[model samples]
Target: MTLTQHWKEIVNLVTQGQRSSMHCAIASVGDDGVPNITPVGTVFLRDDHTAYFFDSYTSQFAKNVKSNPNVCLMAVNTKRSFWFSSFLKGKFSSAPGVRLYGTVGELREATEEEKSAVHQRIKPLSWTKGSKLLWSDFTQVRDISLTDFRPVQYPKMMEHLWN
Candidate 1:
């Protein structure tokens, strides 16, 4: 389906996924035609069918994207409660996850608004060591123009959710 058709729900699921799993998987193709999956936690989706991610330590992912700009990003709600309840009830109130297909833009310097968004997102872990190690520095970003999406469906459970 077109990402625009389900943009809001897609955003909600992706945000929940990041919160539960701490990251989403972004797939890109290397020059050798091998696929690489990068788990990134700095992805931020906007109201439009666009998103940007902090390119702080993504050397490998960056190289892959440079070679081939096309990318697939999969975001899933991985919360135990979400899974347990859905499986137990044999139904899902909404989609459990979504995969977004887009093209990565050239890595560019982040704007003040972008920087503030990152800081705010990670403010809860401000004093933590891991946060300092991973999120303390983010100056560059890569934007993605989302075009398509695939819903994660569990045979019977999610059959009606998206209908």
Candidate 2:
């Protein structure tokens, strides 16, 4: 299906994942063909089937993407309470997560708007030293052109949860 068909649902699940864990695991293939999964915290999804993430501390991921742009990003609502509630009811009120397959463009400087968005996202934690040490500077980004999506499924629990 085209992204437009399930765009809203994809967005919702991504938001849930972000709110729950503040990060996603993006898989890429390294030069030796081994898979690498990186925990990235700066993923930003757009309404137009695209996304981007800051590349501040992901040197290995950056090198892998340079060789092969294909990537699979998996984001799940990892909140303990959400999973507990689903287990109690034997069903999920919604899909718990999503996986997005996409191609990353060449890394480039982040724009003012993108920087501003990141600042806003981490504002609640801005006062903490850890926040300052970790999230203070986001200078580069790589744009992702999403091509496909797979909803996270738990057999019977996730049936009919599609948008």
Candidate 3:
């Protein structure tokens, strides 16, 4: 399929809340000239075309992004019906690192609408006595521009889900 088509599917998934987590990979030149990939749990989506995630103040993923600024963000839907297993291989990527290259955007004052939308979508996912779902405190907003996108592959497993 065309890249744009792939992007549209991803956007739909995010907007529809079908995809729960974002898989972010940062390929940075290590001291030994090797590339490192760090996946982070994403938490926010400002719009269908924009999103954000929470990272520790001293996370290696954040550090790598600061240094290289090149990254790839991916979203996948693996919860399809049993009949659609053939499409289980479907995946999306943000065009190498061009989709999110450069410094991340700063967190701005969330509009009333933005806040309402966030509240409607997320209900504090409390799990334990001290386990509060981590949020960036409305201060860790990152902006990644869209460059390109594509579906990875089509697998029979997808039919089991999609079906």
Candidate 4:
């Protein structure tokens, strides 16, 4: 299918799911030009076309994006666990006028509105020993202009992978 059509399907899947958490991965060139992938949890979307994330000032993902400006995103719905997967990739940038990719950059500071939302949705989990904890007000937002997309009609085996 065309990119636009594929994007529509992806969006529908995400919107219909019970849980919609943003998946972010940044690729950094190693000493030998190989790429390293890091999974991060501080990601969000601003409306249907814009996306955002929160991270510490010293996060590797934020650092990598500032230096490289290349990033990838995946949104999955696992609650259903039948068959589903979606992903996105583009240059990681700031909302107003900051270009961050593979270097040190500031995370978007949360606004009062966002703070209100967090208070409503976030629940306090029990803390345990040996847990790596971090707190930051950094927010990262991006405007994604969907330029290309593709859809695959996978077999049952592959369908399980998507789910």
lDDT string, candidate 3, 41-122, tens digits: 4434433455555444426555555555555554444434421543343532221111233234443455555555444444
How well is each residue in 1-163 modelled by candidate 1, as lDDT tens digits?
Answer: 5666778889999999999998989999999999989999889999888999998777788999887999999989989999899888989877888899999999899999999999998999989999999888899999999888888887778767654
**1 against 4, candidate with superior TM-score:** 1
TM-score of every candidate relative to the true structure: 0.96, 0.96, 0.55, 0.50
How close to the true structure is residue 126 of candidate 1, measured as C-alpha lDDT?
Answer: 87
Model 1: lDDT of residue 52? 97
Against the reference, the lDDT scores of all candidates come to: 0.89, 0.90, 0.43, 0.39
Residue lDDT tens for model 4, 1-163 = 3433334445554433314343344345544445666554444443344444444442554445555554444444433223322222121111111112322234556776655544343334214331224433334433333333332333432343222
Model 2 lDDT, residue 48, Cα: 86
Give per-residue lDDT, candidate 3, residue 33.
52
On a 0 to 100 scale, what is the lDDT of residue 46 in model 3?
38
Query: What is the model-wide C-alpha lDDT for candidate 2?
Result: 0.90
RMSD per model, one decimal: 1.0, 1.1, 6.6, 9.9
Question: What value does the lDDT take at residue 54 in candidate 2?
Answer: 92
Better model by lDDT: candidate 3 vs candidate 4? 3
Model 3 residue 83 CA deviation (Å) reads 7.7
* Span of ten consecutive residues with least summed lDDT in model 2: 154-163
